[model samples]
Target: MIERLPARAFAAGVVTLALVSGVVSYLMVQPDPAVDTTRVTAAPAEVAASASAPSLVTAAGLEQFRRDYRDRFGDTLLDEATLHDEYASIERAVPHSPDRVMPYSYRGTFESDHSPTTRPVGTPEFDLDALDVPLLARYLAGAPQSVGVPDGSVSHVGLGIDVGEATVSIYVSNRAQENGYLVLTPDGRVLAVRRFEP
Candidate 1:
């Protein structure tokens, strides 16, 4: 004799079969584990040497040097009244010295409205005496010749001095509003003492 299955029973059996098949398929598929470690390496000896080297100038040393600079050349560069005036007018008028051409030993370039565009990148050393500015020539004569770094912008109190033949630039965050000067020297003597600002 033929037997007939109930509709509800037939549906329940089909659902159970599907659930079992899904569980078996998932268990059979497993992920593989691998990592790429190419960038990891031991440190170099030069890096270790650089990390251990001592600095040439310390913060205290720099302050002492600045104080010495003031004491030695302060009078020739600027008096108290002039310094105050320069500070007061620093925001308005900043004097730009003539383009100075020196040997490419120490070279730096900065952007300024006054900077000359046609100036050679690596100009040979020219005689400072040939320049019309006497103070600049004198400063170059007295100071040890070195290269000037590019000073980006003129701050409230910017200082430029000749270190050897190269110009060293300094910026003062707090300038007295009475008077000031831009002094350049070769052998530690004041070169050009121009009233930088008002």
Candidate 2:
């Protein structure tokens, strides 16, 4: 009976320790009520939805954005005039070495037309004319199936001009998540394909 008593006492001690530890752990992980989380509490999905991404990657798209801006606030640079995504800028070749033409948002002056954004520049230019639009259309249509993302889930399409090559970045759902970009050349050549599973 004495031995059983000791065992019971030991079991009770263990149970008490466990309950205390669990309570401490739970309290440690809980968010502080005093902290303001209003600005930082956006869910992944909500953040994705709220993120500003340009719909088009061409010069025409740039024109559209400018037109929209003009329609809303005439001739004045507003807070929304900023290009949230740097990838939205298209690289165009200029005559001078230190002067490159790009959109106003991408380090360029606020101009309705593509204007020179001064930078140490290069020879080969992003050939917008050489882009195989028909081929790109077909590939983007099949990108969901080919890249293993949800069907018809193309969320954003942006352009990036790197090393004088025109590359397109396509986001399936949320670009900020584990899912990455489907990078392709303007000629419809696949550069990199990344997909999100969860």
Candidate 3:
């Protein structure tokens, strides 16, 4: 009976700790959806579509992006359907400004799963313009995950044209290991998703 008493006390303590932890977590995760629109002409759209975001570039969008890319550069090696399937599940799109002329950009956070001190919280851009679907499609198609995998290896896509240097890089989880970046062009033309060493 004495041993039982100790066990009961331990269980009670554990329950109390769990309750406290849950309450603390709930308090911490409560979101304050506040936005400052003092500088903007209009406030943010209240009916932000969570279902449609981060926006899936259709098969046609893919072709247009290819057209724009080809118009500016040359013919691309990327196929329309192949690119569409890659980013089909991008559910959340970070909001972006439309004044920018650059075609490629990224948004959101990427805290290194392996490193404690590394945080890739880039507010680059994810705002797809009225006709920027093709650009987004290009980026999505260029993602390594969009590529086909080999027998023992992961995604191995070799169908992109390199435009020398790029400023935008999107994160693509490389199986169970490192992350990849989809480098894009000004008009979302040339692209590649290569593994980045941490």
The candidate that achieves the highest lDDT relative to the unseen native structure? 2
Q: Cα-based RMSD of the predictions, in order?
A: 34.7, 23.1, 24.3
The order of the candidates by lDDT, greatest first, is 2, 3, 1
Model 3 score (lDDT): 0.27
Best by TM-score: 2
lDDT of 1 by residue, 92-145 (tens): 111132233211110011123342223233332212122223222222221211
**lDDT scores of the candidates, listed in order:** 0.21, 0.38, 0.27
Cα lDDT of candidate 2 equals 0.38
Q: Per-residue lDDT of 1-198 in model 2, one digit per residue for the tens? A: 000000000000001111223222100111134422111010111112222443333333344454554453353232111122232333333434335544433322333365556655443434344456545544444445444554335455654454444565555544443343455666755545454455
Model 3 weakest lDDT span, ten residues long = 1-10
Question: What is the lDDT, from 0 to 100, of the residue 103 in candidate 2?
Answer: 41
Residue-pair clash count for candidate 1: 20
- Once fitted onto the true fold, the runs of candidate 1 whose alpha carbons sit more than 4 angstroms away are 1-165, 169-179, 195-198
Q: For residues 24-70, could you state the per-residue lDDT of candidate 3 as single tens digits?
A: 21001111234111110101112212332322233253344345444
Superposed model 3: Cα runs more than 4 Å off: 1-131, 145-166, 191-193, 196-198
